[model samples]
Target: MVIDTATTSGDTALKQKVSSLMSTLKSDLCDLVRIRSTAGGATTEAANKVVSLLKEAGVSDATTVKIGSGRAPLVHGTVTGRTGKPTVLLYAHYDVQPAGSWNETEAFTPTEVNGRLRGRGAADDKSGIMMHVGALRAFDKNPPVNLEILIEGEEESGTGSLEEYLAKPENKDRFKADAYVVADTGGIAVGRPALTATLRGIAQADVTVRTLDAPVHSGMYGGPAPDAFMALTRILATLHDDKGDVAVEGLLSKPWTGADHPDETTYRQNAGVRCGVPLIGTGSVAQRLYFKPSINVTGLDGAPPPVHKSLNALQSEATARVSIRLVPGQKPADAVAALRRHIDQHRPWFLPVEVTYAGGGEGFEARTGSTTFAKAQAALQEAYGQAPTTLGQGGSIPLVNLLQARKPDAPVLLWGCEEPAARIHAPGESVHLDELERMTLAQALFLKALSQQ
Candidate 1:
């Protein structure tokens, strides 16, 4: 990654301006993080807060658009630029994942420690919102290119509200742009700059197993009666072979040709892998994560807590939510079908089994050969003192595919401040201050370069 030193005087001034706004950025980010805007929770306050911030940043038309009667609101706004300059659509999500039991810090309370902001959504997406806000403020909300801001409130939920809204013919023209910047992804490390060039899609299913009509005493049926919980465990065990790779047939995968993943020690530290537990699967970390199908039992029910709530009985039924991450070129429907078939074939004791489809979306591969991509690389190089590397994200953003399909020619850039250490969707989520500042400057520089083109 070679560093470029061809920054113009204006670029230098912009960098200085962004630096001066760091305190404000941190303050604003903390304010946003203070709001408990978890998906399906009350998010109207968060939406209004974003609209107010955008308006204060010089986007006077910023407001929240209701998606449906009960769905979360979408924050939309635009800043007009000089005629002949291209339009750039900026995207980020304000909704956050639920804070589970693992958080070291309070999930909604914003805390700053060692130059990082700690809270739920601080790095996953709320920081993404701040990235756009800080950049627009650096330019006094008048960017070099025409700007269309569409901040979603249901990205973490995977409800497809934004996708359905954008699909409408009446609303298509408002989102059309020469370039799109999705600020929901991030680099590989704290100082390393990366643009997510590909993203794995998601497919999910609910698997239920039934053996008997009702529970029976374990003392009487322990040896012969089929236990639905035990049966469910056996069925789930078949999802992965001995090597821990997905055993489902007809799913697609390919060799990873992008930037290499972190080494084992760093990867373990980032993932918080328990010590002495060997990593499952074959091939390199990037290959396993970016270019292959993986399955996880995300939820399970019908079994009581083993410690105090356990019953010594043969359970009649059990159910689990299975989540599958599909590689590029794999259809969500096909993956779900394959998963259902695999579940049916693996049922033990000729038990009754059911598999039902859940929601999912297709993966995305960016058009990285475009001039906009080059500008993004140069901008990141200028911001981080090294040329950016392209990487693939293991997560899915269904909206990215919709945008790409809507405007096939426009390049969609995915970059953000959330590095591996951020622990997004987990406890102790945080965003490094320096990474936030650099990402903001990079976005500002990319917009300036696009205006020049």
Candidate 2:
């Protein structure tokens, strides 16, 4: 961690400037993979061609960083390093995730299977924004840190203008930084090399159940009716207790001392786990999927208990959709008010229960003593040669907890470029090519070791 960036004063011209920027990154990754930019608001014409590819990678101040309404247009850009040095922000996002079944042709075409490179935000982040524009055009774009390529088009629909484009107090002293380069993650296998400190924060709740008012009469009041689908299956069987964990009441748990997963028959073929199902409650799947706090009842809309709706007799309702995964200093609206006081004091029989509220994001444990996480773990052990294993991504980058709740000691780092089997939004999502050239040399030797830290 020592840099002083004069773009590292030429030395064999930085390996011929990363080989002429990998031939202009295969034509700028096929022109941002022909843009579909997925998820609603299509992301302003691929965020205006990534703000004209960050003003043609020179970034003498790029643009498009709008707020709220625009959906996905946080392309801001900047340059300036030499004089004094120290600076490196680089975050990534160009709005994606949402491109299924293309019957004819157009998930934004640009295929190229064998050499690996598809569409829908190719590898969950335009291949980490074309490896930060091929390591800033192999230094020709003058990268050695002191850059701030903060892209975003709503990180797949959550980082919407990421906390209003990093709450503008003049971008907190021009996004002051010493580290941060999420070239998207992956590498527990292939060449194996990962370094994702931690990220877990989220809590959502949605439970509904009512008895009497409309459709009823299962065999003329099937045994003294009043059945909102067996009272939402006995309130989802009292929210799991007898060993299945999660009994709600004040949600939060601990004991997942950082990264150590994959062991349940490789998690039944990486989460397919069917035969004699039992990969649920145990220890370490990154400790119940990234450091504790998980209770998913997903969804359960009413009426239709396996066919038999005897017209209108009265009413009977039932609905469930609870989602929780908060961890970093838990407070997703107080774990959604303790799952609404454990489903209003578990009175499923007396009926009348309605607790609704969904939307939460605040979980990240990233603070393993910094210095840019130890030079991003020696640039992921020199770009995937080995040693680099640290995990905890129970998925929740709600704008990195809104930029760590407005720079709570800013130094956020999360990996990207698709991994959990790159099925990102599903269907042959793809992204491998030597783990995208070892994540473009671990984001170009972590921006030349944070521009000479």
Q: Which candidate comes out best when scored by lDDT? A: 1
Per residue, candidate 2 scores C-alpha lDDT tens digits across 1-453 of: 441222334433544555556656756766776676766745788888888887777886788866766656678788875676766678777777666574214555657677666666677778788778777766667776577778877766554456654666766655656555566656555566676767677766678877777675567777677778677777778877876767787877778875576556765775566888776565667787777777787667874644464454434776777788877778788998988888778876666787777777778777757776777766666555566777777777766655555556767777755666665665556666557656665666676766665
Return the number of clashes found in candidate 1: 0
Clash count, predicted structure 2: 19
TM-score of each: 0.96, 0.35
For each candidate in the order shown, give its overall lDDT on alpha carbons. Answer: 0.88, 0.69
User: Which candidate comes out best when scored by TM-score?
Assistant: 1
For model 1, residues 42-75, the per-residue Cα lDDT tens digits are: 5888999999999999889999998854378999
Worst 10 residues of 2 by lDDT: 3-12
Candidate 1 residue-wise lDDT at 429: 91
Q: State the TM-score for model 1.
A: 0.96
**lDDT of model 1 at position 178:** 88
